[model samples]
Structure formats: structure tokens, C-alpha cells
Target: MKGFTLIELLVVVLIIGILSSVALPQYQKAVKKTRLMRLAPLIKAMADAEEAYYLANGQYTPFSSELDISWPDGTLAGAATDDGYLRFSDGTVVDLLSGSSYLTGSASAYVMGKTKEGIYYIHYLDHSSSPGVRSCKGDESLCKSFGGEAFNGGWKIP
Candidate 1:
């Protein structure tokens, strides 16, 4: 006599479920966006290191002492493996998009994973390409399709 009817209980449960379902995806998206934004500073730092190395060595080296990245040191399965993001020798980190490590390409290009998926690329744009600017590239197909915001003489989210 003091308990709610089955219909009322079911309605309450359904409402809760619906609310949670709607909010969960939105929360996940926000988290992913935060993760993507968090990498911006790291990418910028890598670019700065590359710039400093270029000035000191007269050319960019894959490896730069400017980065104090923590590289793993140890051997696994009788093989020595180092999990270092900075290449300090060639300025490149292999398979950066894979998220196993931060990556750099060519002389002034760096790419890192964004959020739960995709990748963010920061590199120098040649004057012929975008009037010479350091630009960050997001999902390329999205950029081409949606026309991302322009900044620093190039697309900020391209």
C-alpha cells in the first residue's frame, strides 16, 4: 500500500535511462575535445625545440636536447627497447599518429593524436602554400569539406 505502481516505476526508470543516454555521449565528446586541446602545448613545445635546434645546428636534427622527454629504458623479451618520443637525431618520431609516441616529420612538421581518435598536425606552411605560417591541421577531409577557421595565414583547425 506504500509502494509505487509498476507503471510509475517503469516511467521513472525510462526517464533516467533516456537522460543518461543523452548526456553520456555529450560528456564523452567534451572529454575527447579536452584531450585534443591538451596536446596543443606539447606540439608547440616540440616545434620550439625544432626551431632552437635549427638555429644551433644550422639545420634541424631529428634529435634535440631541448626536449626532456622521458624515454623508456629497459629490455623486453631479450631485446632492448627505448620508448622515447624525441628523436634528437633526425627530428622524426616514427608512427606518431599511432599514439605510441609523439611524432615529427620532415624539418618542421609534427603530428600527434587527438582525443580518442584522429590526429593533429602542426607544421610550417611554405609561402607558396599559405604565405609562410606555422599552422595546425586537423582532420584533413573535414577541413576540406567544412572549411575550417583561418588563422596565422592558414587554417587553424585544418
Candidate 2:
């Protein structure tokens, strides 16, 4: 009588498994959310720095040193490559492009943004045109598309 029966043990195991199945997904979602959130400050900093650089030089500087950012690992300073993607150590990516989009003209317009887990934040600016944030709640694919008249098609940062 002191020991549990097989049926009781099985029932307990089943309950535990069911709870874990439900909880694990939520835990993963929270972790992904946190990872995305951590990029927000960096994105904002880059945008601010870009704007300042534009004000000072009349155009945004692609060099990370000029932007005055203490870049983390995997930070791509400028359009070193054709993709214009800045890969982070955490697997998130940022695309800081000037003008219309990556591989486009040179201008004061700038976009510093990041995407992770289908969430994205884009700080867009063009001194003579549009300037604002383009945020995609879900679906990274949607984020890739130009948001609207107020938003320009940013570079595909992966």
C-alpha cells in the first residue's frame, strides 16, 4: 500500500507531459520575444547616430566608427557587401541602409532596423522626404515588403 500503483504512476506521468507540452511553446515564444526586444535599444541608438551624422555631414556615414557605435560582434559597418546586412552574435540581423534601399543611391535617407522571429522594427528617415518607424507585428515576410507611402523598402537583412 505504501508504493504507488502502475495506473496512478502512469496518470501522473501523463499529466506532467501534458503540462509540459503546453508550457514549452509559451516559454519558447517568450524567449524569442526577449531576443527581439534586446535589439530595440541598439536599433534606436543606430538611428539616432545616423541622424546626427547626417546633421553633421549632410549625409549619413556608413562607417561604424563614424557613427560612434560600440558595435557588438558581427556588426557590419557599412555596405561592405551587396546585401547590406549586419549579422549579430545572437543571430538577429540589422540592415542600415542609406537612400531608397540597399544598393541604391546615396542620400540622407537612412534605415536602421532589425528582424527576428517574425518581428521587426525599422527606423526610417529621409531629410527631404519620409521619416518614421515601420514596424511589423508578425510575419517577417511582410516586414520585407515596403510598408506604405510613408515607408520605403528596406534592405533584406538576414
Please tell me which predicted candidate would have the highest TM-score against the true structure: 2
- The weakest ten consecutive residues by lDDT in model 1 span 94-103
Assess the local accuracy of residue 27 in candidate 1 as a C-alpha lDDT between 0 and 100: 84
- Candidate 1 residues lying further than 4 Å off, grouped into runs, are 64-108, 114-116, 121-155
Expressed as tens digits, the lDDT of each residue in 38-131 for candidate 1 is 5555555554554555456554434433343433453112221234233312132322222211222233344332333553444441212332
On lDDT, the candidate that comes out on top is 2
For each candidate, the alpha-carbon lDDT, in order, equals 0.43, 0.59
Clashes of 2: 0
lDDT of 1 at 53: 54
The RMSD (Cα, Å) of candidate 1 is 8.0
